[model samples]
Target: MSLFQVQGLVKRFGGLLATDHVDLSVAHGEIHALIGPNGAGKTTLVHQISGLLAPDAGRVLLDGDDITALPMHRRVAKGLSRCFQVTRIFPAQTVRDNLLLAVQAHSGSSFRFLQPRSQAHGLYEAADRLAERVGLQGCMDGIAGALPHGAQRTLDVALALACAPKLLLLDEPMAGMGPEESQQMVQLIDSLRQDMAVLLIEHDMEAVFRLADRISVLVYGRVLTAGTPHEIRSNAEVQAVYLGTETLEATP
Candidate 1:
């Protein structure tokens, strides 16, 4: 059975049909890339899956269980986690503290203000291991806001890892990064695919092509096609709708 299934998903905003009867399935340990031009409802689909928005029609199933009605926090508790396109961090806190807070949240404990940092040893240890996994071990003592852009992005992934999710949704993870940073992000994501299913929304075609086991092309709030990298590269319909004739001609 598929790890996640979205069947006939539909969403509307007044007269605009944001997602039009979309059907998508993701298998376990697969990196599924969702790609499209601007306003293709990619983000809208993310919102729906992450429980930020409700679908007007269809069902979302995780591990064969329907989760269409579950709220965001409930979904997180059920092992679904997401990272936003923009960096979401505790700007005032050190990287270690930020990760500790995430670990505490994941552990289902209320924040305790008077407790010493050392008292949260278990959480700190787990956070430290996650930080190392994402290449943030060296910067643990730095203020989160003071890190370089690439390190900050790594921290974002680490926070999601702290959630111990079964399915991870990443939205534009490579956005606004230099070539080196983008490469690092790609490697980080590649390292993660062994343990979890990933639903990735990215505008960087190169990164998508590099990492995706399969690609779904969305256009005008509908899925135009889905296939392997080779098939998508050669698909006439996909090229016509998104790549254009000139760009298609340039592809080898």
Candidate 2:
């Protein structure tokens, strides 16, 4: 059975059909990539799956449990987490402080009797692990906003990891990244499938083809087709509508 399922999801905004009976699934440890042209409703579909917006019809299920009506935080509590397109971090704070806050938020206990959070051994250790996990161990004391763009994005991913989710929703993680940064993120995302299934939305075709176990194409809020990378790369319909003729002309 699939670890996460979006069944017949539909959403509407007045006359615009933003999402149209979309069905998608990610199996255990699978990296499923969602791709589409601009205004194709990829963002709308992601919002519904991440609980930022509710679907007008159909269900969002995690491990076969209906989460369609759940709020965002509740969905996170139930092992679904999301990283936004823009990196979200505490700008002025040290990376360590930012991580501590995220760890504390999900740790389920307030500080006791004006006690310093730094005195909490477990939080510090957990925060350290998160830093190492995202390759931020050396920058723990550095200001979050001062980090390079790719590092900031990596830190954002670390924040989502604090939730220990079963399925992670990554929205355009490679956006704004140059080739090197994009490659680093591609490596990081590729490693994550060992621990959790990932629903990735990205426009970087090379990275998508390199990492995705399966790819889904969307157009005007509806899924056009889904298949392996080779199938997508070779499909004449996808080539004409989304990938473009020249984009894959050089590819075998």
Candidate 3:
């Protein structure tokens, strides 16, 4: 069964329909990718899914619970986490401090009664674990803004993971990375499917083909096709659309 579902999702900006009755589903342990050309409204669809924007008409269900109308924070609490195109971190804070803040924000209330010093240990342990999960342990003491671009992006994913989400939304995770960094990100994102389903909106065809279990091609605010990587790669209509642009010939 699908763990996340978006039904008849519609979003409008003036007379232009940014998202047109779009429907998408992601199963547990699946990496579903959303891809399209510029101006295809991919980002708008993501905004609605992540609760960053309210849809004109649609319902978002996570684990069978409706979250379409909830605000961003409420949706996050409901196991919807997003990693944005830009790195969202405290520039002056160390990696450990940044992870600690995120962990504390999503943590339960059990530490309320504990002594201050004892609480510190628990937070530190959680922070360390998060860092290690994304291979940021070596740079735990590095300044957040000072980390290399790839590491900053890795840290961004770590921050999203801090929420313990069931469905993780990755928005152009490899947007500004070099070839090497992109490769590392692909591997990191690949690892995430072992834990939770991912709804990835990315422009990098290579990464999408490499990591996606299911791929949905969007055009003009609508899903043109949805299928496995091999199916999408071999679709004639898809090729026709991208014929003037780059070919989707990358191997996973």
Best by lDDT: 2
Stretches of candidate 3 exceeding 4 Å from the true structure:
108-117, 243-246
Writing each residue's lDDT as its tens digit, candidate 2 over 27-111 gives 9999999999999999999999999998999999999899999999999999999999989999899999889889988897574
Root-mean-square deviation of each candidate, in angstroms? 1.8, 1.6, 2.2
Q: Candidate 1: which pairs clash?
A: none
Between candidates 1 and 2, the one scoring higher on lDDT is 2
74, model 2: CA deviation in Å? 0.2
Which residue pairs in model 3 clash with each other?
A: none
Q: Please give the RMSD of candidate 3 to the true structure.
A: 2.2
**What would you estimate as the lDDT of candidate 3?**
0.89
In candidate 3, what are the lDDT values of residues 197-228, reduced to their tens digit?
A: 99998888888888999999889999999999
Model 1 lDDT per residue over 134-237, tens place: 98888899999998888888898888989988899999999889989999999999989888999999877778878999999999999999999778878998
Runs of candidate 2 exceeding 4 Å displacement: 111-119, 249-252
TM-score of each candidate?
A: 0.95, 0.96, 0.95
* lDDT score, candidate 2: 0.93
Error of 1 at 173 (Å): 0.4
Instruction: State the displacement of the C-alpha of residue 157, model 3, in Å, after optimal TM-score superposition.
Output: 0.4
Name the weakest run of 10 consecutive residues (lDDT summed) in model 1: 243-252
